[model samples]
Target chain A: MHTLALIFPYAVAFTVPLLAASLGGLFSERSGVVNIGLEGLMVSGSFTCAVVASRMETVLGPGNPGALWMGLGAAVVVGALFSLLHAFASISLKANQVISGTAINMIAGSLTVFLARTMTGSGNVRIVLGFIPSDIPVLSGIPILGPLFFTKTYATTWLMAAVLAVAWFVIYKTPFGLRLRACGEHPQTADAAGINVYRMRYIAVVLSGALAGLAGGIILVTYSGEFNGNVAGLGFLALAALIFGQWKPLGILGATAFFGFAATIANVSQVIPQFSRIPGLLLKAFPYVVTLIALVLFSKSSQAPRASGEPFDQGKR
Target chain B: MSRFKNLFTALAAVVLGLLAGAVFMALSGSNPLAGFYYLFRGGLMNMERIGNTLASATTLVFTGLAVAFSFKTGLFNIGASGQMLMGGLTATAIGLSVQMPRMILLPLIVLAAAAAGALWAAIPGFLKAKFNVHEVVATIMMNWIAYWTVYYTIPAYFKGTFLETESRRIPALASFRVEWLTNIFRGSYINMGVFLALTAVIVIAIILEKTTLGFELKAVGFNRYAAEYAGIHVPKNIVLSMSISGILAGLAGATYYLGYAVNMQIGVVPSAGIDGIAVALLGANSPWGVLASSLFFGILHSGKGFMNAMTKVPPEIGDTIIAIIIYFAATGVLFTRLWERITRKWNKEA
Candidate 1:
């Protein structure tokens, strides 16, 4: 129980960013677009958030939360704008989605660093402050669950949870969500039904970009506290989580949590004496190896959107 | 006419990329003309600099061939970085451990690297062939697996005396840098890898153009179902194409770690693998085209540092230019449409 409490906060910290990004992926893939540029999107967001927050800190003074909020807002906006490139190439220009996504990654990676070098000679931006963790007043009074879920938690965790809930409701319950899924499953049928397939996919892809940007912002304010031009491949991990979760909202949550826990255990094993018996290498490589096995297991029953990677052509039968 | 069109498209993409880079430079308050002046001059000003550019091109040539070869069979081999790492690791292990004559040892190292890379890539090929999995995702998974594997293997068995991040340097005897070649290039890192890359270019060209296997592979790439119906073994060819691609990438790793760099470093997924995609696209996925495109990229890469030192432009501008070119290449269809519209306008005017 003691150790569980000790690691729970860290686990949640890891899970929130992944959950946010995976949910973003869910929106894009469900809209009939395969977005392999999630990693690049996250990098752009992180870079935007870092630059905005660091600049705001000098004016607002250190420890002000307002700067972080402003940074998060900027990240979301930039992320949405950046994704338009992918949308244009894949949607309008009819380019290969995977290749376009790869180009997106390369552009984000190089351009951000290039700009950073011009702004700050070092090409790295570190903020003066991040969100401080505090126990929830009312929730902390609970017995077992409080310590695991509420105590010593960053406010961003609850914010992400709320976002997850809203995503679930919007995707599963709304008429718009049905149109989006229909576009992915059978765009021709959806077009005949007057669903405006292109518009739905555009909206979905943009929303995903915004959410992924928010995920990057959350990483900046919560745990990462810096932007180093790359997100350590967390975006790719989120893509894996989306696949592992079978593209459902709740499934994404479960899969991200699993990866988050595994990552936390690997990270903290060196500090804890009980975990010292396991080889550090094994612990470090555990999640990736498990993801591979999961891929093999799930490949046969994949729930991927049928028309996800295909460009819609009205002239085709 | 189609070949000429491909050449024109590639040239246009390069022009667009450079213009985008200039826009970035102007935004950064640097003189784009001056930056480019220094950039080209840096790559060609002296014998040593030219040698460095060629040395850089050697690695790009092999990786470019790797990507182009796989594209011939309709597979996107994004795992070239992982394959390169495995190959480099194999060569590094042998270089560090073995005591042998240079003639015999170099061949052994090259062969070992090739085999290691081939095995690494074959797993993804197998998965794609057997499980009906998408090669893109599978290759990505393989890349991370290889990353973690290297992250583990390097520090555990091959750690340097002072730094845990890198391995011990290869001895001169095991290195691809020979005395006469070093003297000819005025003590630059130019090595026998250039010859190996040239030889690979010729060999791959022959395999792709002159052999029945090449015909089968291209047929499979054109249309898998049609090729299968025509009695070609699509699955076998897919694996074979990937394996051959892996062999090229592995040889690239050998050239890089054994020839250019002295030691292996952990935690970096080589950018050369991703850059190979750009090379292949620019080269039109042809062997000779790959060689030409790689040399251009080589100049951009090797000149970047010198350009940074000489001007206000940041070194990352070179990488940004490469990336923009890739984005433009991915949208090559847009250019084709624009070209048709312009041609129609010209005809109307005439």
Candidate 2:
């Protein structure tokens, strides 16, 4: 196999979670809520998915694929429900967006660890339903793409690709997208135009949570073999990707892929002689270095929504 | 009355946070009163316990001051952990390499740590001021960069004899512990770090309350465009503000790695950095408020272990209880509004 082929699988795995989570951020930020708690949401979702899948695996016999999907579904619901706290704090209570988001992070992280300790008894949770690849029927026959794209890939990758497509359409072409963007850019004007700005924001935030939850689920069943009560700052990295992507779905895909590619190189450096000479720690830090440089280079007038972090108040304007 | 609202809200938050923890303790099948009693008693049982609690709080004081200072300037310094790491790493690097008199060497190492931390934080501050990068994302990215920097630096330079995960222990001369203070505290880890923290508190209080520079920074935080209109040099102040915040956190790192623990550990951002935000929020971002809250948090962190040992509740549950307190504390604005509504209703009835 070509070197790129070996690296492609892991890169795709890395891309899936970051891309999904950033898409979640895109939805929330586009509707004017800054969802910094994406990390917490991802963590809770990962734990929920892992625990559910593990229990189901025990009952349904090992290697049952349906159990994985069921876990993913549960994760989506849990993530959204968890995020409602953030939505309520930031919206109705008019709390500081940053504080509210971080509070959610603290609560989610500690709560999951506490529950897992009580439920699992060993203070950790792991699942044995691993991601083993099977070749797609005809797509596996394609020349260079066959081995790289279609061989031994998990079903979750295809699911993410489908999600990206739908997300792009929903956020770009749909009427709902227009209203969401309007809510973020100018909630007062959006309200004047008969858009229910608050309602739109709520929907956008909830949708973001659902997608982020899916990202967490994908990470557990694919990238990492076990859930460790951590998405390990992937949520924050996703936020970086969201900002880097300029808060557009297509741009987020590109940004997340770039980060995913950096992360893949870091983890696989021991196998590649060219990268082997560099310290392993530097390689681990490579993605962050890349992110910082990208931020510095592109930090100009971040095309963020004008009213991004402010609470919308109809009375004030 | 509204002038004292922030203080009132913070007090309410602390009380509510404790109540929430008590509720969790009750649910966990432990007596809430006993839990509270153990929690406080562990921190105040003896001179040694008091010393240890204060020693633990020493880092929180600096990190809280760092966060609160940055909050005043309208920037979120999420990279305080990274700054702390850099400070600790620099101090450790100095302690490992230098052979000099204690008086000269200590101040030199402390300055080096502060400079490194300030430089680390200035990157995000500069980016935010010059290019419009959001500090939250940029600082988080900086954190990983700092984390990896320590990960690489420690093993390459000061690897311990047994543990690959931490640096070699600092010699006694470079250590923050003084023989007299340790004896006075009955062999607790208490050191001169607490004094350093107190001095920092006073200096920061003066800076925030009595200086034009502080006023400029606060104005910029309140409204950037308006500050710009007032010719306050907003960009300069942003960088300066972050630099100051970083310096404080770096001091924390000095006390933490050099004073609290003899060796620096790899692959973990200091939890004190995030907890600092809660301390600042509960403190209402005042210098003295931050100090008070840091001490409160210190007791919770230090006493948590004993609470677990005495009660049936696990360590994770104890940590969760602390998290619940922080969550409620950070949601001060929500409670503030609630407080305001109740007050209005009371006045209407009266």
Candidate 3:
């Protein structure tokens, strides 16, 4: 029970970001733009959220709940706007998607670090917000389930779950979903069938940017409660989780849970007797190792979208 | 006409990037002219700074070569970071462990580092060649593995003290330093590593331009189907190209550790692997081109601190500049095509 207790918070926290990013990835990939810049978007979003939330605390006397929402809104807007760079490079310019994506990653990384340093008057800042966990009246009394599912988990976790459910429905059950998938499978074919491949891809990539940004925001306001250069790499780990989940929303949820569990173990390993002596870095490396193994095993069987990383060319097609 | 168009396109990208940077500076309330002045002066003014630039450029040279080698074979070797880390660690181990003469020890340490990098990169190369797995994701995952493994192993097996995470310094005999270069620069860390990097560029140029193996690799890169039909072993060439690329990346780490730092300390050495990508990309993934690009990047990096010292601008402005430069460089060719099309359309109308 105690072990479960130790693992659950991390599991919930990890899922929020992973699910959001994976859904974002799905949308973008479905619309035929492979978004390797998801990590950069997340970092930008995290920085925006942290800075906004901290500034709000300063302005609103530290106890305003609306500060968090404002930060979330700021993150989404920043994320969406940044995605425009990728859209312009990939969709409009018809550049190599990987290179453009990598450029975005570099730009985001430098810009975020620069902004954070400038904003905080130092290299680091603690983001303060007024969202403490308040128990639901009747639901709070349920012994194990309440704590595991509801009581201690941040509102973002529930939000992620809702987002995932909506994503699943929108992606798999709707007409727009069919068009998006068709665009990924064969953009020329989709175009011939009267679909706007460019517009769809642009929308998908933008949505991905927004979700990645939201994930970044959640990490800042909920889990770490601070923003630093460390969080920049989490988006990459989320990318790993996206692949490990085999690019499915449900699969990604499970993969994130596993990684989250590994993260929790690494975090609390010092408390555990036998694992304490092992270097914490090695334990921390577990999820990456698992991801590598999973990729090695499944890559042969995995079927990526036909137009995964290729920029669409109307004339060439 | 095509040459003129290409030059114009490249100039336009440079102009656009500068404009964007100027806007950013203005938004941040900094004087753009003062910032550019600091950047230009810091990078080019004095002898000590030039030596510092050369030292950093030497490291970038190896990384650039590594990236270019794989790119010529039509592979994006994103695992260069992991390979470089492994190379550095292995070279440090050799440098610390060996008691041989300088002539033997220096080459041996470098060779071992190259091998370590090659072995590390081979995992992804093999996966991509054998299983048709995308190298990008695999290489990225490999990077995380290498980083953590190196981080963990460094403290566990090579800890020199109870408190410090760094290993013991390399023995003096195994180190590579140029006395003349050091004298000229008045005791800067500039060494024979720059010559070695130049030699590598020459060797890569020869191999890429003059060899049958290079032809095979290029054929595979140009079109795998055509290469296979031409009786070239596609998978073998892919693996070999990646291995060679990895070896160069590793050699970069080795040179930095054995010739420059003389000690392997976690988080102290900048990520030569990631920086190598920028160097390679900016060089247009050409061997000679990479050499020139690396020198430019090295100058910017080495002068960043000097710029901060001389002016009120932060060192991160250098990173911003580098990022913008790389972004423009990556899309420079595309911009050229767009420019050509626009010019042709105007010419037709006229």
Supply DockQ values for each candidate.
Answer: 0.75, 0.68, 0.58
Error of 2 at A76 (Å): 0.7
Reference-based lDDT, residue A123, model 2: 58
Query: How does chain B score by TM in each prediction?
Result: 0.96, 0.95, 0.91
Candidates ranked, most accurate by DockQ first: 1, 2, 3
Cα lDDT tens digits, model 1, B1-350, are: 56766787788899999999999999999999989988888887888889889998999999999999999998889888889988998999999999999999999999999999899889888877777667777777778877777887888888988899998888998899898988878887789999999999999999999999999999999999999999999999999998999999999898899999988999999888999988998898999989999999999998988999999899999989999998998899877777777777988999
Q: What pairs collide in candidate 1?
A: none
Kindly list the per-residue Cα lDDT of model 1 for residues A1-317, writing each as its tens digit.
89888999999999998998899989999989888888889889889999999899999977578998899899889988898888888888878888888888899899999988899988888899988999999888799988999899988898888999998988889998888888888889988898887788888878888888888888988898988888888888898899889889999999999999999998999888888789877887788778777878888999988899888776664
Which of candidates 1 and 2 is the stronger one according to DockQ? 1
DockQ of 2: 0.68
Across B284-326, the per-residue lDDT of candidate 3 in tens digits comes to 6778878887887787778777766775566676677667766
Q: Is candidate 1 or candidate 2 better by lDDT?
A: 1
Clashes of 1: 0
Model 2 has how many clashing residue pairs?
0
True contacts kept of each: 0.72, 0.71, 0.49
Going through the candidates in the order shown, the clash numbers are 0, 0, 0
Model 3 chain A scores worst on lDDT over the 10 consecutive residues at: A121-130
Q: Encode model 3's per-residue lDDT on A91-184: one tens digit a residue.
A: 8877777777777877887777766666655646577653565566678678998777766767777788899898888888999988988888
CA shift at A201, candidate 2, in angstroms?
A: 0.9
